[model samples]
Target: FTVVNRNVVFMKELVNKTINLAKLNSDKIPFNIETISLTDEIKNSVVNNQVLFEENDIVVENHVIDEIYVEADHILLQELLNNLITNAVKYSLEEGGSISIDAVQKTGSSDIIVSISDTGIGMESSQIKQAFNEFYKADDSRHNLDSSGLGLNICKRIVEKHGGKIWVESPGKNQGSTFYFTLKKVKKEPLKQKETSISSI
Candidate 1:
């Protein structure tokens, strides 16, 4: 009965992922953009996933600078964080694994770069390059067990929608990995367009 229930839940999640991917591919996803505190949002995501970390005996850390605000769709941003953190937890060991979330403003740009680092089964150079590809899974053996290969793809779409870029870095297998994404920061004051009047010649 337990196995059946688990399978049912997995199937439901798979269906939802498939629907979301379809919506993304068809350019039908809607976003409600607003200015939000990045640090608070990230902390909330971590808090939401506390059970997962606790169950795996993993340590979660935050290095986000306070008062970092950005223009983003709150729901999509949360989804992005959830996907990244889920990946970190999935590949990490059952003990002594640690995940860190960091955010900083990009020099000379009104943008913020966020990274999620994990001490887990890291990827190779080739794997890192294809990490955001649709249906790309670094570890095929565990794909069905924990991943549908659409999470990161969805994350890439969401980031791009916000005029941001996402990428992954790793030293080598077992050395750990870090996924970084950039988002435009909310301007202190909104930009205003100047009006011009036509004059008779």
Candidate 2:
């Protein structure tokens, strides 16, 4: 019964990914871009996946500062994070490792770079190049049956849709990997000044 339940869940996820990929290719996916707090968004994503983290005995650290804001589709951004986090968990060490998320805005740049790093089964130079390609699995033996191989591809599409770029970097096999993506930054609005009317008095 447990095996059957797992298969059913996998099938549902596979179907969802297929539909989302088709929609993305056709440019039919809707995006509602708005100013969002990067730190808060990451926190929300982590909290949403609390069960998965606990089950895998993995530790996640979110280091994104609260002051950084970005223009993005909230739902799509959450999905992107979820995909990356799940991918990290899949390749994590047998004894469990750590995943860290951080964001930085370079001086004079309008984009904020967000990185998700993991102490997992890292990839090689060749694997990094094709990691975002649809159905491109780095290592079949390392991946579970539930992986549809479309998560990173979907992530790439989502980042590009937001006028950003995404890439992965790793030292080597068994070292670790880090996924980085950029998003347009939004400045906070200045406080309005109150008017002082004393002439009437």
Candidate 3:
């Protein structure tokens, strides 16, 4: 049953990924942008994957400011974070490990940088460079996992569309990895449009 269920889930993810790629290629991906609370979005993503986290006994540490806000498409941003956390869980140690998510306002910049770090199988420098490439897998076959390798690539596209950047880092294999991305921050208050009243004769 577990195998069957995992396969089914993998198939669904693949289908959705194909559709997303199609939208990206045709330039028809619509984004509903608005001021959103980053903390809430991140928490929602975490909740969505609660089952997987529990199954693995992984501890997730969220270091986010509840008041931090960003101008972005809530759905897309959630997907981006979901992909990162999913990847972290996928490559994590079998004995269970810790994952930390942090969001900080970049110094001297208008971007909010978010990072997901995991104590799992890490990647080499060369693999880090091509991590965002479509269908690129870092490990040869330490663990047999069903992955299309398009997750990070799609994440890169989503971040770029938001005028942000995404990257990964690792000291070396067995040292663990951290994925980071940035998004434009928004002030606590939305920008108000100036109103002009016309006088009628």
Candidate 2 per-residue lDDT over residues 1-201, each given as its tens digit: 478897898889889998877766764445567777788888888998888788778899999756877877777788898999889988887778889999988679898999999998899999999999998878652334368789999999889877799999999998999999999887775323233211110
User: Estimated TM-score per prediction?
Assistant: 0.87, 0.88, 0.88
Residue-wise C-alpha lDDT for candidate 3, range 63-141, written one tens digit per residue: 8856788888767788898889988888888788889999988899988889999999899998999999988877642
The Cα RMSD of model 1 versus the native structure comes to 7.0
Q: Which segments of model 1 are wrong by more than 4 Å? A: 140-145, 188-201
lDDT of each: 0.80, 0.82, 0.82
- List the pairs of residues colliding in candidate 2: none
Clash count, one per candidate: 0, 0, 0
Task: Kindly report which residue pairs in candidate 3 clash with one another.
Answer: none
Candidate 3 or 1, higher TM-score: 3
lDDT of 1 by residue, 30-69 (tens): 5567777888999999999898787777798898857787
Worst 10-residue lDDT window for candidate 2 reads 192-201
